[model samples]
Each structure stands twice: as C-alpha cells, then as structure tokens.
Target chain A: MIEIFDLEKRYGFTYAIRDINLKIETGEFIGLIGPNGSGKTTLLKLLFGYCRPTHGHIRINGQPPSPKTNSFITFYPEIDSLYGNMRVFRLIDWYSRFFTDWNKETEKKLIEFFNIPLNKYVRQLSKGFRARLKLLLSLSRDADIFLLDEPLSGIDPASRDKIVSAILREYRENQTIIFSTHIVSEAETLFERTIFLMDGSVILDGKSDDLREKYGKSIDTIFREEMYA
Target chain B: MNTMEFERDRPIFLQIKSAVKERIVRREIKKELPTIRGLAVELGVNPNTVARAYRELETEGIIGSRVGKGTWVIPEALQEIRKEMIEDIIDKFLNNLHSIGLDSKEIKEILEGINDRDI
Candidate 1:
C-alpha cells in the first residue's frame, strides 16, 4: 500500500504538486490521467524517492519512502532513460543485475513475445520498440508497485494494442500498478480506479465505473467535461 | 477464442456478465463457461474482473463452478434465467421508449413494426 499525506513538491516558488493525499491499496490497477504538466510525473517521481518533497510525506508499505523503497517500486519514467548506445541483449543483461527479483523465465518469454531483435542497438529502434523494451525490462521484475508514466504514448495504434496486451498478460495478482496517460480513451478500459489531476492537484478520484455511471458517458468524455468546465 | 470487445461507458465486469447472460439465454453456453484466466486473456481484462463477473452470475443462479470441472451454465435454471433476462431486456427497451416520450400505443405500434421485420 502507498500512503501520501499532504504531499507537496515545489520548484523554487512554483509548485508542481501540492496538498495531495491519496491511499492506494495493494493489488489495484490505477490510472493517473491529466493534461500536460499536471504534476503526474512529479507525483510519480516523489513516490519513487527520486526527488524531495517540499512539504508533507509519502509512505510505501508503511515505511517512509527512501532509496530503500526502490526495491519494490518499479518505475518507468516518461523520458527515454535507456542508454541509446547499448545493444538490446547487453542492456537486458546489465539491467537485470539491479533487481533481485528479476525472473529469467519471464524475461525469456517476453523477449520472444515482443520479438525484438536482440542484436539491434537501442538507439536504432523505433519509438514503439523502445517502449516495448522498456516494458519488458520493468515487467520482468517481481515488484510490488509499478509506476508507468505514459507507456502507450507516441506509439502507433498497432503497437499500442500490443503494449496493452503485454501488460495484461504479465500483470500479477499481488502487484499494484499506477500508470499515467493522456490517451484516456485507449487506456480507460483497463482501469478499475482513476485519479484525475489538474493544475497540480487531484480534481477527481473514484471507481471508473461509478464516474461513468454518474456522468452517463465514457470516462474520456467525463474527463474532458470536467477539465474543460 | 476471439478477443472480446468492451464499451468504455460502463464497468467491464457488467458487460462481461451481460455477455455471459446473453449466451446462457441463447443456449450458446452448453457444457462449460470459459476459465477465468482464459476469458480474462480473451477480453484483455484483469482476472479479478472476470472472477467478479463469475461470482455475480453464480449469485444470480445463472452459472456455477466445481473444483477441477471448471464453470458451467446451470442447466436446471435455464428457463428461469431466460425469463429473467428477457424481462430485463424488455424493461430496458420500454424504459428507453418511454424516456423518448412514447406512450403505450406508440410502443405497441413500434413492436408490431419490429415483428414484421426480419430480425
């Protein structure tokens, strides 16, 4: 479980995320959705202990989030964090050394499932292939919490389905996944609960179905009406 | 199995439940329902979602599962299930028709029109 208490993150005088209090239970698939620069990345980074909060605190599994929290939190940043110069197979070998729960069997299966040419350089791959590789690396780890930032963004429609299918196939019963995306229509079906962020704060949070029932429309439509209203 | 599609306007488990209920009513579900894992993969939904769908169906006496035998339609309750489901569909259709300001006579006219068509 992740517990956040009055969480705030500021850059100089400007705030990125403020007054955020959320409690995510175990074994949930949460969708964090919003427009650009809505503090989605900041909130995820704060959860991963990659940046310091200006105020408030976050707890992972009842402990204060620190470097140790990284053990169970597998974070896929929105940016391209892979070493562009490295070959695919070599990169896998290097990354597997960091996580203790790296499953070799899962890695082998995903490697074949994605059908990524292991001999190609990471920089030489297309955007879709890179995202697949990143997902392969993250999903192979037996982590308790997964924070994926826009895993489906900037990919072709065909690759989007493949990526979403891969995630559904590999997700375990014990893990809690929080994925942020701007493409709400495509990703909305997979969400049980959703958090809608706006201007650095949560504007709405609830079961996706309840929201849809209340609005009498799709989550994407509700999101647009809420954000634009 | 073909990939089951879902609409984004409502809960997926409800859609899954309705789909299964439709199959049961149509007698398309013969021996057994698909395994939770199999259906989940086919629909690209969480297994927990499929499990909830099955649990609700079981609660409604539409289906049941036994250990190692997998889930199956309740053959004995098929007639009752059909009655309840048809009633539900009619209720929804009538509600929609009334919501659009149609009275009973107009609804009957529309029903007659539908009956004349090759449905």
Candidate 2:
C-alpha cells in the first residue's frame, strides 16, 4: 500500500505538486496522466525517494519512504540511463549484480520475444529497440511497486503493442505499478485507475471504467475535454 | 480470441465477456473453457480483467470453475447467457429507437414489421 497525504513538491516558491492525498492499494495498476509540466515526473520522484517533499508525507507499506526502500521498489526514470557502448547481454549481466530479484529466465524470454540482438551495442539499436531494452530491464526486477515514467512516449504503433504485451506478461499478482504517460488512448485500456493532474493539482482520480461510463467517452476524450475546456 | 475486436470507449472486461459469450453461443466452447491466464495472454490483456469477466460469467451460471480442475462452460450455458444478454440488447435497442424520436407505438410497429420480414 502507498499513501500520500498533503504532499507538496516546490521549486523556487512554485509548486510542482500540491495538496495531494491518495491511497493506492497493492496490485493496483494506476496511470498518472497530464500534459507536460503537470508534475507527473515530480510526483513519481517523490514516491521513489529521489526527491524530498517540501511538505506533508508519503508512506509506503506504512513506513516513510527512504533510500533503503529501493531494494523492494523499482523505479524507471524517464531519462535513458543505458550505456551506449555496452553490448545488450553485458548490460543484463551488470544489472543482475545489483537487483537480487532479477529473473534471468524472463530476461532470456524477452530477448527472444523482442528479437533483440545480444551482440549489438546499445548505441546501434533503433529507437524501438532501445524502448524494448528499457522495458526489459524494468520488468526483469521482482519489485513490490514499479514506478514507470513514460514507458510509451516515443515509439511506433507496432512496437508499442509489443511493449504493452511485454508489460502484461511481466505483471505479477502482488505488485503495484504506477506508470505516467501523456499518450492516454494507446495505454488507457490497461489501467485500472487514473489520476488526472493539472498545474500541480489532481483534477480527477477514479476507476478508469467508472470515469468512462460516467462521461460516455474514452479516457483520452475526457482528458482532452477537461484539459482544453 | 485474437480475432476478437475491442472498442475504446467501454470497459475491457465487457468486451472479454462478450467474446466468451459469443463462443459459448456458437458451441465453440464445449465442456472446458480456456484457463483465464492463458486467454489473457492470448488476448494481450491483464489477467485480472479476464478474471473479472469469468467471475461475472460464473455468477450468471454461464461458466463454472473447480479449485484445481479449472474453468468450464456449464450445461445449458448458451440459453443462460442468451437469456441475460438478450434483455440488455433489447433495452438498448429500444433506447436507440426512442432516441431517433420513435415512441412505444412506433417501436411496436417496427417489431411487427420485423416479423413480416425475413429478419
């Protein structure tokens, strides 16, 4: 379980996220959606303990989040951190040394499924392949809460399907996943719930299906209307 | 299952349920239904979503599962599912007809008209 109470992250007298309170149960798949600069990334960073909260508190599993909690929590930052010069298989070996929960079998299966060449350097891979590699690394971990930031930001429709399927395959029954994305229509189907943020505040938070049924529109449509209206 | 199409505006579990109900109606699903996990993987959807659909089907007596034996279509599952789904279809149909400015009398006339046609 994760709880955020009156959470705020500020920079130079301006708030990135403000007055937020939410409780996310275990095994829930949540989508954090908003336009650029809506503090989606800032909120995720606070939960992962990468950034200190300016006010209020966030607790994970009844305890305040800390760096030590990194062991059980896996966070995938939006920025690409993979070394370009390293071969694909070698990077897997390096990641295994840090995460005890790394599943080698899943890594091997994903490699085959994505048809990724182990011998090629990361720099030589295409944008789609790079995206696939990033996802493979994230899903390799057997973590409690998976914080994924923009997993579908840049990629063709074909590769997006593959990446989405890979995510579905790696989902464990006991895990809690919160992923942020602006491309709502493509990924909205997989979300159990969604949190709509605007200008550092939550505008709406509810079950994805309930929101759909209430508005008689897709989540994407609702977001566009709320944001543009 | 892969051949099934899903709409973007509705709940995914409903699409899964409709697909399964269609198979049952066509007699494609016999004594045994596919495991929830297997069908989820095939459809590339969350297993929990498929579980929800299966649970609803079970509640309606269209399908049942044992502890270790797995899920299967119940006897007379077709009639059970059809009886439940047809009412919803008719309700929607009537609501749509009304939306087009048709009253109950016009709807009754359309139903009578349907009886005269092959449809």
Candidate 3:
C-alpha cells in the first residue's frame, strides 16, 4: 500500500505538480496518465525517492519511498540508459548479481520469451528488442510495487502486444502496478482504474467505467473534453 | 481491504450497484444485499456512494426495499437481467465494430470466419 499526502514538487521558479493526495492499495493495476510536462515523471520520480517533493509526504508501506522501499518498488524509467558498449546477455548477469531477488529462472525464461539474442552488443539490437530487454530486467527484480513509465510509446502493434503480454505473464497477484502511458485506447485492457493528470493536478481519478459513463466516452475522450478543452 | 485495486473507470456509485448485481447474478448474495454501512466497510468506500448505488438499482427494478426489513433482489429479476444483458452486449459489440469503420458486410464476414474455424 502507498499513501501520498498533499504531494507537491517544484523547480526553482515554477511548480511541476502540487496538492496531490492519493492512496493506492495492494493489487491495483493503476494507469498514471498525463500529457507531456504534466508532472507524471515528477510524481514517479518522487515515488522512487530520486527527487524530493518540495512539500508533502509519500509513504510506501508506512515508510518513505526509498532504497528500503526498493525492496517493494520496481521502476522502469521512460528512457533506457543501459551500458551500450556491453553484450546484451551480460547485463542480465550483472543485475542478477546485484539484486538478490533477481530470479535466475525467470530471467532465463524471459530471455527466451523475448527472443533476445544473447551475443549481440546492446547498441546492435533493434528498437523493439531493446525495449523487451528493459522489461525483462525490471520484471527480474520481482518487486511488490512496479512503476513503469510509458512502456508502449511509439511502437508497432506487434511490439506493443508483445510488451503487454509479457507484463501480463510476469505480473503477480500480490503486487501493485502503476503504469504510465499516453496511449488511451489501450487503457481499457491495460488497467481497470484510471488517473487523469493535467497541469500537475489530478483532475479525474475514479473507476474507468464511471468516468466513461459520466462523459459517454472512453477515458481518452473524457480527458480531452474535461481537461484539454 | 484494497478499494483502489478494483476501482474501474466508471463512477463509484455504479460500481457499488454493479457489485450488488454481480453477487445477485452469481447467487452468492441471493435476496437483500448488505446494508450501506456493511458494504462500505467491506469494500472501503464512502457509505453515501454505496447507498446511492443501491437507490439507483432499486429504480431499475433489479432490487427491492422494505420499509424496515432491508433490501433484496426482485424474484423475477434474474431472468430479466439475463435477457437485458444479451441485447446490451450485442449492441455494444456491433456499435464498436461499426465505429471502427467496419461495415455490416465486413462484420458478417468476420463472424462467418469465426464460425468456420474449428473449435
């Protein structure tokens, strides 16, 4: 469970996001969605303790969202900064050595499931393959809370399907999943609950179905009408 | 214990109503559903939301209320609900396909292809 109270973040002269109060319980597949520069990254960054909130408090399992919280939270950043010079397979081995929860069996299975070549340099892999590699690395951690930022951006249908399927297979019942993406139509399948963020505030946060009924549209359309319009 | 876990894109009141309807459909909760206080505690939501959902379901003839006895499923509601669900599901499906630019002929062809395939 995560409890966020009046969570606020700001830059020197401007506010990124503020007055965010949310409670996420166990076993939630939450979709954190917003436009660019809408504080989605800032919210996620605060969850991982990578960035400090100028004001407010965030607690993961009654404690700060930190390296200690790392045991409970696994994050997949929007960008990949893997050591491009190294062979792809070695990176998995390196992570396995670092995070003890690193499941060798799961990693081995994912390597085959993703069909990622073991011998090629990370830079040599195609864009799709690289994305799968990142997913595999994150899932290998087996944390209870996962914060994924835009895992399906700018990908082909097949690639997107593969990523979605991989997540379905890899997800555990006990974990809480908070996934952020811009793709709206896919929300119906990807998440059961939706959070609407605009200009750094949670304009709409409710069950996906109610939001749809109130506006008589999908979450995407309601968002455009409510916040963007 | 985790209200956020199952939160849908729909309104909170409708979710409460749907939960009661689901239990009725499954026969797990045959008759009068739990009181608002009980459901709110069980699901960890606002009491008012649950009450509102129950009120709406009553108006729809899916459930009934006794002045002092409590609430319950209408005896004939099970059959009526099943009948209602068939048309609603079909309508939503065809409308979705049509909205996506598939014509009636294209939809018929797709349906036929599914039928032709071996189970």
Candidate 4:
C-alpha cells in the first residue's frame, strides 16, 4: 500500500507536481500518465524515491520509501540503464546479486521466450531488443510493486501489443503495477485503470472503461480533446 | 488492502463494476466466493472499487447476499445480463441513429444487414 500525502516535487521554483494527494492500494494496476514534460517521470521517480520531494510525505506500507523498500518495488524506465558491454545473462546475474527477490527461473524463461542472446553484450542489441531487455529485467524481478515508465515507447504497433500482453502476464495477485505512457489507446486494452496527465498534474484518472463511459469517448479521443481538441 | 487508488478525478467505481460484470457473466466468480477485502487484495484494486462493483451487481440482481454468506452470483447469470446489455446499448444506438435522422425501421434494417454479414 502506498499513500502519498500532499506530495510535492519542486524544480528550482515552479512545481513539477504540487500538493497532489493519491492513494494506490496494493495490487492495483495503475497507469500513471501525463503529457511530455508533464512530470510523468518526475511523479514516478518521486514515488520510487529516486528524487526527493521538496514537501509532503510518501509512505509505502508503513515506512517511508527507501532502499529497504526497494526490494518490494521494481521500476522499469523508458530508457536503458544496463551496462552495454555486459552479456545479458551476466546482467541478470548482477541484478540477482543485488536484489534477492530476483527469480532465476523467471529470468531464464523470459530469456528463452524473448530469444535474447545470453552471450551478446546488451549494447549490441537493436533498439526494440534493448527495450525488451529492459522489460525483461523489470519483469524478472519478483517484486510486489512495478513502476513501468513507457514500456511501449519506440516500438512498433504489433510489438507494442505484445509488450502490453507481457505486462498482463507479469501482474501477480499481491502486487501493484503502475505503467505510464502517452499513447493511452495503445495500452487501453490492458488498462484496468488509467490516469490522464497534462502539465505535470493528473487531469483525469479512473478505470479505463469508466473514463470512456463518462467522457463518452475512448481514451484516445479524450487525449485528443485534452491535448489538442 | 489499503491500496491507494484515485479515480484520478474521474468515475472509478463504474469501471470496476463493469469489469466485475464481465467476470460474473463468464461465471469466473461463483458469487460470495471471495470477501470484498479478499477480492480487493487479490485484484490489486481499491476496496472502494470492489465495494462499488458489488453494489451495482447487487442492484442489477446479478449477485446477492445472505446475512452471513456474503455476496454470491445469481444462478441464471449470462442470459439476463446479456439481454440487459443489449437493451442498454439499444437506447444509445437509437439515439445515435436518431441524430442522423434515421427511424427505427432503418436502424433495424442496418442491424439486420450486420447480423446477416456475420452469418
């Protein structure tokens, strides 16, 4: 369980996300989304405790978000962070050493299913393959909370669908899955709940179907209206 | 389960209700099988959303409760629910059809054409 009380992240002077109060119960699949530069990354990092909030508090379970809490949380950034020269299997081995929650069996299965070469350096992989590696790294962790930032980015439509499906498979009964993306429609099919972000704040959030039912339009339609329409 | 979920400024309970409805229609839930807290915990959804879904299902007669037995699915689940859904859509379909100045007869013809195509 994560309770964010009046959470505020400051960048110099202006607010990245200000005085926002949200409670995400354990096990819910939440899609944290906002427009570009709308603090989507900021909010996620704040929740993940990567960046300090200038004010307010974020309490996960009972304690503040910290490295101790890191074991229970797994974050998948839109970009890559693995060592390029390291072999894929080696990277998994390194991560498993750092996080005891790493499941070797799951890692092997993902490697086989994705057909990721165990011997090749991660840097040699294509952009799509690299993204898959990031996803694999994130999914392989047996954490209770997942903060996936734009898992669908830079991928083609067919692959995007596959990634979304993979996300569904990764969701466990006792965990929380939070994914952020700009293309709501692409992820709408798997969207149990969605959060619409613009200008660094959550402008809309709800179950995906409820948003469509209330707005009388699909999430994509709503995005068009919110951003440009 | 103390999971924090915001409707993110939108109606959340409604979405939950529909998702539960789908499960109920498929008989994936046997009604009153899992308590609200358990369901919320299992689904990783907010307890409020689970409560709302239960409320709506009860109102629509898809599920019911006994004093101690908790919520249970109705035996005759799918037929009535599907019929209800079709009736629910008919109004919206007709309204959209009316917006284009089409009458019931024309709408029926179009639906028949669609049905024929599927067959």
- Give the number of the best model, judged by lDDT: 1
Q: Write the per-residue lDDT of candidate 2 for residues B5-112, one digit (tens) a residue.
A: 667678888888899998887788877888876787788766777888999989988888998999998887678777777898899999999999999999999899
State the TM-score, rounded to 2 decimals, of chain A in model 1.
0.98
DockQ for model 4 equals 0.09
The deviation in Å at residue A2 for candidate 2 is 0.7
Kindly report the docking quality category of candidate 2.
medium
10 residues in a row with least lDDT, candidate 1 chain A = A208-217
Q: Provide fnat values for all models in the order shown.
A: 0.48, 0.44, 0.19, 0.02
* Cα distance off (Å), candidate 4, residue B51: 13
TM-score of each: 0.89, 0.90, 0.68, 0.71
Model 1, stretches more than 4 Å misplaced?
Answer: B1-4, B66-69, B88-119
Ordered list by TM-score, greatest first? 2, 1, 4, 3
Q: How close is candidate 3 to the true structure, as a TM-score?
A: 0.68
* Real A-B contacts recovered, model 3: 0.19
- Order the candidate numbers by lDDT, best to worst: 1, 2, 3, 4
Predictions in order: chain A TM-score: 0.98, 0.97, 0.96, 0.94
Flag regions of model 4 displaced more than 4 Å: B1-119
Tens digits of per-residue lDDT, candidate 4, A1-229, equal 9988887888898888886778888878787766788888888898788999999999989788899888789998876788998998788788778787888887877777677888899889887778777888889889999988988878876656556656655566588888888876556545667777777667777777577678877677787788775
Pairs of colliding residues, candidate 2:
none
TM-score for the B chain of model 3:
0.72
lDDT per residue as tens, model 1, B1-119? 25567777777788899888777777777869988877776787767778888999899888888889899888877888778888998999999999999999999999999998999
Better of 2 and 3 by lDDT: 2
Q: Is candidate 3 or candidate 4 better by TM-score?
A: 4
